[model samples]
Target: MRELERYYRVLELEPGASLDEVNQAYKDLAFVWHPDRMPQDNQRLKDKAVSKLQQINEARDKLRSHKARLHVPSTRAASQSASNPTSQQTTTSKTTSRQAYSSQSRTPQEPSYQPPKPHPDLTGKDYSGANLTNRDFSGRNMSYANLKGANLSDTFMHKVNLFGADLSEANLFRANLLLADLREANLQSANLIGADLSGADLRGADLRGARVMIGDRVQVKLIGALLNGAIMPDGSIHE
Candidate 1:
């Protein structure tokens, strides 16, 4: 179990840590060690960060796959998600989950809940391979929307609500998504090259295997997004 031990060590977890713990540790460490957050002039640190990120990714992948075989208590979530795939797309009310509020990016004093927008109602809408480039959909609630393989390049989606939207393998290159609410969104393998997500909320969002960066140091998609508590492509969370 040398390899297993290495994985656990890389994620900073005790050996035989549960799936939840592994996932959580990966997120936490990713946030603290992402290359983009590092100083630009520190080439040595950047190189080290790159290496660390790679090890973290490998650890998460192996451990997750290993945990899948055990089907432990946490496997219930995976089973449930498989049974009701739409469950992953449910629009989680911020006020409803008190635990989420405890770790919110917003300051304890700020009270700007909004310009109340509509509840996300686009459940399971398929827009596969569609060219939706440059269309404006700011501030609209689109929770559970299925936009797999869609071309969203140059789209104006500032402050739009995309909670739990599925954009897997979608083309979001150069899209302008400033302040967009993308909480719990699925963007696995999406092409996010040149996408602008400055100040966007990305808590609990999945970005596995996405083309988000040009190099080890450059942040292509997450240039200015509010990544606090966001889950990255490598299963790490941004602080």
Candidate 2:
């Protein structure tokens, strides 16, 4: 058995779990195995608590990615349908019918399957200049994380908390950053072309010299958000 196996047992779940089951399991186990719940008298127990927390976080990430992959095909189809809106609907209907039949043929009371875990120490790590294109970071708490100069083209960051994060010079072209909190974040010289910033809290964020397209829809909350030196989609500068 692996070291993380102990953590899986603590959560009373197998290592290979589906995303839905991973979310539910994390909620249940966090209530019991939280560091606050453990006594601080023994150093060994405290260490164990830390290890368990890392394991749980890793498991959740793995499951989330696995679940996200399952929806990719459907997403691509939907994107195509949005462009055509005619022939794709017929194909979609047939596919949906086949999927319904497949689901019914499967076991009625199906248990959730577990997926692989992620690296334990990914949070707050420096990921400068990394290629993170088309990645999903939805609902993740990445406060104070350093993503400077990272390539995040076409990524999805919906509702992610990025307070005080460093994202300077990052490439966020065509990214969906809807409802993300970028308070006090450093986004100097970052690319926001075609990025959806609707409902984003950009309070105290540095947008000086940032490349922002005018065609992209951005609902700015703060008054002092710098519009100078921003490149609009109309091929004009947002002065």
lDDT by residue for model 2 (112-198), tens: 444457624345768789999866676778878899999988777766778878888999887766677887778888887766665
Error of 1 at 27 (Å): 36
lDDT against the true structure, each candidate:
0.74, 0.65
**TM-score for all models, in order of appearance:** 0.47, 0.43
lDDT of 1: 0.74
Candidate 1 structure quality by residue, lDDT tens digits, 1-239: 89999999999899999988997787666645757555657899989898988889999999988866554233344344345434345445423343343445244454433333665555566777889986667667777788889999877676778888898899988776767888888889998887767667888888878887777854564545666776677778788
Q: Clashes in model 1: which pairs?
A: 27-237, 139-160, 198-224, 207-233
Model 2's alpha-carbon lDDT is 0.65
Where does candidate 2 clash, by residue pair?
16-114, 17-113, 17-114, 17-115, 18-113, 214-232, 214-233
